[model samples]
Target: MSLLHAELRLILRSRLAAASLALLMALSALSVVSGLSAVSRQEATIARATAEQARDLAAVAKAYGKPDGEAGYAAYYSFLLTHDRPSPLAFLALGQRDVQPTVLRVRALSLQQQLYESETLNAEQALPGVFDFAFVAIYLAPLVVIALTHDLVTSEREAGRLRLLLSMPGTGLWRRRIGLRYLLVALSLLIPAGVALVATSAPAHLGLGILTVPAVYLAFWFGLSLLVASRVRASATAAAASVGYWIALTLLIPTLANAAITRAVPVSKGIDLTLAQREIVHHGWDIPKAATFDRFLATHPEWRGHETFEGRFHWKWLFAMHQVGDEAVAPQVAAYRASLLSRERWTARLGWLLPNVAAQGILHRLADTNLVAQLDYQDSIGAFHKELRAFFYPYLFFDRPFTRADFDWLPSYSARTGTASWPAIPMLMLLVVTGLILAAGAAQMRRTGRDASR
Candidate 1:
């Protein structure tokens, strides 16, 4: 206890150590605050969207609620709102939420057209990414570790205390120093994170699960720092090597990997699907209506007998044409989604090799703010769209009048339930990598202690 206390005091006495810890803590706290604010804004936007949707629905009801109102016009004009609420731990990571639309008004029209429409954003602001807790833990915190531990052995040698300390110490002298720094770095990050968990009222078990990521991540950096410090004989060389490693791991490698993954998995199928759907819908106007009905009825065979209409134009035909357009691109849609999932899978595979990527995947997965979460939200919207079609199909096909009471029957969208499960495999990889680095660091430390004792 006394030895640990002494080491802690010694670390505190260093201006660099003191300042690095203080700055790290402050940055962590600021990031948490920024994340909370971003989440609050998102919630506010959702609330406003909900209220606006209510007003819009009421207006649609008032406009189209006549006893003789045609179902086609009502379905055409009434745009129902669907939203993806932020996950409980979203503030910790933010992920792609900053750019993706949370609330969307989707109607019974061709869903392929509406699913990809997003509000324009400031490209510059989004390009840098959100400064959330995950950013601090993944990017900035390791730099602080470098600052504190890069000179762990070299500084002792410089001060002429290396032989004296190695000669007098029992075992774990290096362990004592490294352990103290690890605790300090962990506290600097986890304290703000703990506050955030409390503020957000996040589940205890889940918060702990999310917190484990940074704890393990910091250990990886510390172990690497210790390994570098033990191997390098000069403080400046150790610091430079540590910083260079940080750059390669966090910045250069990720950038290159992203380019490689994108090249390997082209997602141009999204554009192809949209264009094909548009082309099919456009051609539906010139081609015979029977051809459109044939395709539509294949999937919705329940409406086969009701396809006949007595007019040059009918609501049923229009709706069927639009549905056919969406159906025409089903294969493309699957290919597009598969391409995206392929990219995500490749990223996870890379996580095994890159700690930064692994930490990011784990945190974003826990927060439910990754590409999978976005895809899930889109799937929920698609399901709701099907319900919308079902609700209006009776009125459209049977020529039944849509009344004011019928407006109330419009299906409401239920937000997706349950959080994304903890990423077990990626996290296990992180632990294994951390263990290997720490083991290497320990071995290096033993060698250094032996060399100093001689």
Candidate 2:
């Protein structure tokens, strides 16, 4: 305890170390605040959009909600709003949420066309990305660790205490100092994050995982810094090497890996699918109504021979035509989704070797902001669209009028809860890598001690 206290005093007495610790703590806290604010804004946007959607629905109801109202027109004009609300822990890592649309209004038409409509976003603001807790943990925290530990041994040598410290009999001296520094660095990052999680009432187990990630990630950085420090005799050289390593691992390597993944797997199939759906729907206008119904009935045999309207503009036939258009591009849709999943799989595989990407994958998956989360949201929307088509088919096929009461019976979208999950394999690989690095650092420190003793 006395030794630990003396070391703490020594760290505090050093202006650079103390300032680095203070700055890291402040940055962590500020990131939490910034994340919370961004999440609050997203919540507010959803609430506001929901209210506006309600107003729009009411307007549609006012125009078309009557016992004598045409079911076809109501189904055509009434737009149902579906949204993907942010997860409870989303503030920590915004991920792909910034570019993806959370609120979308879909009509009882070809869902493939509506699902692919892009949302308008500010390129300038989104280019920099969100400054959240994950950013601090993955990008900034390592630099702080490097600053604190890069000179651990070299500084002792410069102060003429290296030989004296080595002469001490115990193998625990360097361990104690390194361990203390690790704890302080971990606390500096985790304290703010822990407080934010508690304040947000984030899931208990998820919060625990969030806390564990930083401890392990920082440990990896510390271990790497220790390895650099042990071999370099001068503090300046050790710091330089550590910083260089930080640049390569966090910035250069990840960027190159991302580029490689993009080249290896092309996701432009999404655009092709969208274009195919559009072309099919456009061509549907020139096809005979009976031909469209025949194709629709092939899949929806339940509604076969029931919707025999002779009018040129029957709502039942119009919807059936749109459904046929969606069905026409089913193969393309499957290919597009497979391509996207392929990209996600490649990213997960890369996480095994790159800690930055691994941390990102874990954090985004936990917060439900990754590509998987976006794809899940789209799946929910697709399911809701199916339910919607089913709902209106009863009215359209039976030729029953859509009344105000019928509007009340319209199916509302219930968000899926269990879609996103933790990537345990990637996380385990990260821990293994960190442990191996720490072991290597310990061996290097031991080797340095033996050499100095000679």
Best by TM-score: 1
Give the alpha carbon lDDT tens digit for every residue of 98-144 in model 1: 98998999988899988876633456777878899999999999999
Question: Which residue pairs show collisions in model 1?
Answer: none
Could you tell me every candidate's TM-score relative to the true structure? 0.97, 0.96
Candidate 2's C-alpha lDDT? 0.86
CA lDDT of each candidate?
A: 0.91, 0.86
**Candidate 1: stretches off by over 4 Å:** 119-125, 269-272
lDDT (10s digit) by residue, model 2, range 5-69: 98889888888889988999999999989888877887788789889988988888899998798
Candidate 2: worst 10 consecutive residues by lDDT? 116-125
